[model samples]
Target: MVPVNPDVTRFLHDGRLLAMPRRWEHRRVVARWLAHATLPDLLEPLGERELTDRLSELAADPVGARRAMVDLGAVHRTRDGAEYWRTELTEYDELVPDDAVEDATTSEGLHRTLHLDGRRIESVATFYDELDRVFMAGEDRRLRPGLDALDDLLRGGFGAAHGADRVTVVWHAFDRSRDALGFAATREHYLAMLADPRFDAALFRGRLADLEAGRGPTYAELVLEVFADHPGVELLLR
Candidate 1:
């Protein structure tokens, strides 16, 4: 078992550090870093005072820490030069789904399951509508698009009405014409998709043969990835 670092633990658990700072940039940086750094990672190398000291040194240098935290949204400076916790700057929003059932008398009960395969592709609009219905009904549904073109077609949106508990999006090469060329093209396409404004989607690339061979993360990981990638459709992860 790896040891934990006490300074990082104290840094995270201490109420003084957790308080929100006034600067929006600082808060954003803190939120972003906190969101990405898990408790275990912070605790790794348990009882390693040397490692902890390095972290402490970084924390002590407010300017350096602020820059590192910038990626996570924590960019503030105090009189003493120490950083305080802040909120993330992600652009999450709330919009009522078009298919939400209004009144109990006319409301359809929740639609829980949606299976996407080649056959279901024809009713794409209805599929999206049903996603809205399920989300409004307070259920999280994982969405996985096969290609960048497909993800673009859906406008980089889809998820539960509420918010995501866990979500991820993965892109794998399943039916490319040539193995080597297909792999490179698939990765490039996925990177381009990530940059698309209409497609604020995450990308996960895996071996096409491995996926086709049925050796990969469990079904749950796949579902969670779909949920994580589509914050607009994050309610599905719940």
Candidate 2:
């Protein structure tokens, strides 16, 4: 299947970018498309001059394009800026389903099940709402969605007297959820954190930098990592 560039063709004519996008979100999408179009192979690193020359084909300002790509977390370069490559991202375009079989029992039937509907999780805000419905059901403690909060919840503090000995989280329509929570969403999530004084500005700033440089994990991956850290938590992506 031919991969489609997301809403960026409007800025192009005869395969050349007409102009830079004014909106930051539009700029991020355009820059991300530029990085993918120019650097299809993540393993192959291009020299500074070579990369600029390739980017020059798309935009008048190759240097600016490079900067935008770096700023959007589409590409990365060495400290000396001698070499450049595309930042790695989870490909939602083609999702290969997970084949791991669930364990049938959890030691004398202490198994509990939770349902996470990915279709309802369109944004970080909605993601939290769904979490509240599933994990905080019948509990008065409402959680503000954040990684730390999520981590604490995974430790079984959501009105639970004790953490479940074994539990399985069946994430329905997992691909759709992953698509909704992809690069753009994760970038914006961190960007919001960076602006909010309530969050750890320093931590979020570093995370944003890493994300823009493609050195950081996506929000979904971060959540998975949190779940992985706690034993007896099984996630089944469907």
Q: How many backbone clashes does candidate 2 have?
A: 1
In the predicted model 2, the residue pairs found to clash are: 73-212
- Model 1, 126-162: lDDT tens digits are 3344334443345454444343323432333443322
Q: What RMSD value applies to candidate 1? A: 16.8
lDDT of model 2, residue 16: 75
lDDT comparing candidate 2 with the true structure: 0.71
Q: Estimate each model's TM-score.
A: 0.21, 0.53
lDDT tens readout by residue for model 2, 1-238: 1244657777877777767799988887787778776777532467889999988888888998898888777786767888776633223222222321122232233445566778788987888887887777777778788878878877765533145555667677778888777778899998888788888898988988898899998888888888889766766676
* Residue 197 miss distance in model 1 (angstroms): 35
